[model samples]
Target: MDYVFTVRRVSKGAFKDEPGSTYFLKVPEDADDISPDQKVGAAGAGMPDKWAKEVLAAARSGENPRTVQPKGDILIYVHGFNTPTTTMLKRHRLIRAGLEREGFEGVVVSFDWPSASSALNYLEDRSDAKQTARLLVDAGISAFAARQTPDCEINLHILAHSMGAYVVREAFDDADDRPAVASTSWSVSQILFVSGDVSASSMSDGNPKSSSLYRHCVRLTNYSNPFDAALSLSNIKRVGVSPRVGRIGLPVNRPDKAVNVDTGAYYERNEDRFRDIPNASHTWYFFDQNFYTDVFQTLRGDVDRNRISTRAGTRSELELHVA
Candidate 1:
C-alpha cells in the first residue's frame, strides 16, 4: 500500500477541484482497483492524527537493518499540474517502484492537490495551487517537523515537479508569514525540483520570492531540461512570463545551497525512445533509471555533491551523465 494525502473534494463518486477536508489514505497498489472515478472515502483512510504519527514512525525506522545507514528518509512528492486522481495514484506507485529498483529504502508519500485533468485549465490549476499551498505546510511538512524531536534519526525531504514548485515556494513564504509556523524548527533536508515551473530569477540569491525556501532546506537540487516542451508551453501560456528554472536552468546568482543539473543532453540522447510518449521531455525523468540512481544518491546525502557518479561539472553547474 501507498500513502495519499489528498485535499480534493469528493462529489458524485469523484474527486473535484472544490475545497474539502484533507484525508490521509492508505491506498492499495492494485491498478485494477484504482480508477479516476473511484470514491476513496473513509474506508481506506485513517484519522489525521494517527496517520501523521505513522508516517513519522516509518521515517525513523530503517527498512533494512543490515544497511550501514540505519536511519530512514521520507520523500514527500508534490506532483505537477493537470494530473488527475488516477494519474496521481499511478505516479505515486511508479516513484516507489523506481526508487526501489535503484535500492532506495526510504518511504514515498504523495501530497495530492486538486489539479484539473483538462489540458486547458492551466490558469485554474495555478490558482488552486496557490490556494492549497499552505496546506502542504500546515498539514504535511510542518506537522512532521513539529513532531520530530531533536537528534532524530530520520531525514525529511521534498520532491516537487512542475507547478508543484510554485506551490512549494508559496507554501514556504506563507509559512514564514505565520508567527506560529515561523517559530517552529521546521526544515527539510533536500528539496528536489523536477521540471519545476517557477521562474529562474525568483530562485536566485537574495530574491524575496523564494528566500524562505532557501532558508529551510539543506540543499536544493533542480533538474533542468532545455527540451521540456511542457515548460516552454507554460512560459508561453503565462503571457511572456520569465523563463522557468526547469527549462532555462538556475540564475547566475542562485543560492549557495542550490545546484543545477542540466539533463538536456541525456534527454536529447534518449529522446527517440520517448518519441511517442506524451510530455516526454518534461516527464521523462520518472521513467529513467539513471535519474532514479541520481535521486537515490541525493536522498542518501552521504556522497559529496561533486562526487555523485552520474554527474559531471562543478557543484554550481552540472551535467547528468547517463550510466
Candidate 2:
C-alpha cells in the first residue's frame, strides 16, 4: 500500500464555489472563466497554522498517519509555469513516492500557485508566480521553519522546478541570517533547483535585487540541463534575459554560495524513460530514477562537492556530476 499523500497547498488563484449541502468549487485561471490573460489576480489563500498543527506535527505523531517523520526533513515542492492544481497534486505525489522509494524519510508539501495549464497562458502564469511569491514565503516557508523540536531539528529542502524557481526566488524575502534564516526566524537547508527557469545571473553575487537568496541556505544546488525544451521557449520569449539556469546552467560569476550540477548525461542514459514523460527533457526529472537518487543524496546533507567528484570552474564554483 502506498503512504497516504499529504500535501498542504497554498494557492493564489481565485476560487469559485457554491454554498450548499455539498461543496462544489473551482478555481478558474481568469475572471471570465474562459480565456487566460496576463494579470495578477488572486481570490484567496491558505496555511501556516494548519501546516504547523497537522503537517509539521506529523513528524512526531506516534500514529505516523501520513509517514511524515520517517526521514527527518520537510521537502517543500513548488510547481512551475502553466500547471493545473490536479497536475500539481500528481507531481507532488510522484516526488514523494520517488523519495520514499529511494529511502528518503520525510514529508513533501506542494505549494500550488495558480498557473493556467496551457502554453498560451505563459504570460498569465508568470503574473501568477509573482503574485503568489510572498504567500509562499510568509505562509509556507516561514510557517514550516518556525516549527520547534527538542531532540532533532526539522531539515528543510526546497525542490523547485522550471518557472517555479522564480517564485522560490521571489519568496526569500525575510530570511537573512548566518545561512539565510527568515525574518520569522528559520533557515532552509538545501534548495534543489531542478531546471530553474530564472535568468542565469539572477542569483549571482552583488546582484542587489536578489542578494538575499545567496545568504540563507547552507547550500544552493542547481540541477541543470542544456536540452530543456520548455526553457527553450522561455529563452526565446524573454529575449533580453540571459539563458535560463535550467538550460545553460548558472553563470561562472555566481555567488560562492551556489553550485551547478549538470544532469544532461542522466537524460541521455535514460532516453527511454525521458520519452515516456510527456515533455521528455523538461519533465523527465520527475520520472527519472537517477534524479530520485541524486535528490536523495542531496537531502541526506552529509557529502561535500569535492568528495562528490566535482570539477573546478572560472570562479569559486564547482560543477557536481551525478553518475
Candidate 3:
C-alpha cells in the first residue's frame, strides 16, 4: 500500500460552485503550474475511495508499496491570510516538493480554505477558516486511525503559516470536543508556525498540561523573523502586541510551556537575499532555502549546533498599511 496524497478546496457560504479547488499528489518541477482544480487520482476525478482505503490499509499494516521507500504517516499544510486559492495550491505543492527534495517519502495533504484575497476579507474569514481547519484535522486523524496499519506508525505533522497558524492551534485546542471525529493519542510530532500572528496570551490562557492543545503536541517549532514586516503589522492590528513565532515571546527563554525556534539569526545571515526578493518579508520561511532546510532538520529532531540562534530580536520596520 502506497501513501495516497490528495488536495481539494472546501468553500463556505454562497461560493460553493466555483470549481471546489484542487488537491492532488505533488509532482516535481511543475508545482507552480498545477491547479487545485486538477484531479490527480483515479479517472481524473476527485478524491477516490480507493485512495482512502489504501491510506487506511497502509496505516494499519505499516506497509506502503506506492512510495519509493516506506516512510512515516502524513504531513498536512495550511496556508495564510490574503492568499488566493491558486497561490495556496502552489505553495503546498512547493512545500511537498521541498520535502521530497530532502528525501522524505510520505503523503502530503493540503487543506484549502476560502480566503477573499483582500486583507479585510482575510480578517473577516479568520474564525470560519479556523473551523474548516479543525474539520480537516479531525477527519485526517480519524481516517488514519480507524484503518490502523499494524506495522506503520501513523504520525501527523502540521506546517501552518501566518493566519493558518491560528487555524492549527484552534484545531488542536478543539480536538477533544469533537468525539465524532477520530481521536489520535499519538502525539503530534512537530508543529511549525511560520511567521504566525497568534498571541502568547491566547496560547497560555489555558493550563499547559490540561489543555487539549498542549496534550497532543510534542515539539512546537515557530519560525519567526524579527525582520518580517507583515508580522509586525499583524501584531499591531490584532492584539497590539509583538509577533512571536510558535507563540513564544521575547525576553523570556520560553513561552510558558511551548518550545520555540528563534529565526532571527537565520534572517540576519540571509538578510541580503530576503531584501532582494519583493514581498519576501512575510514569506521568508518558505522562500529561503536555508530556512526550509533548518526547519526540516528541526522537525526530524536532528539538532545541528550551528543552526541554533537567538530566540528574540528587534521587530522589523512596518511597511504594509493595515487599514
Stretches off by above 4 angstroms in model 3 are 1-48, 53-70, 182-187, 205-210, 233-257, 276-278, 302-323
Q: lDDT score of model 2?
A: 0.64
TM-score of each: 0.91, 0.76, 0.71
Clashes of 1: 0
Report the lDDT tens digits of candidate 3 across residue range 1-323: 11223223444422231223334443334444333334345422444565565544432324446553334646778777777755776677667667667655555666655555666654566755654655545445545545545555556777888888877777766667766542444456777777776765555535442266566776666565667776664543555454445333322434443555555655666668777664576775666555555555655555532343322322221111111
Q: Tell me model 1's lDDT, rounded to 2 decimals.
A: 0.82
Q: Which ten residues in a row have the lowest lDDT in candidate 3?
A: 314-323
lDDT of each: 0.82, 0.64, 0.55
The best-first sequence of candidates by lDDT reads 1, 2, 3
Give stretches of model 1 more than 4 Å off.
Answer: 31-47, 60-70, 233-236
Give the candidate number with the greatest lDDT. 1
Identify the leading candidate in terms of TM-score. Answer: 1
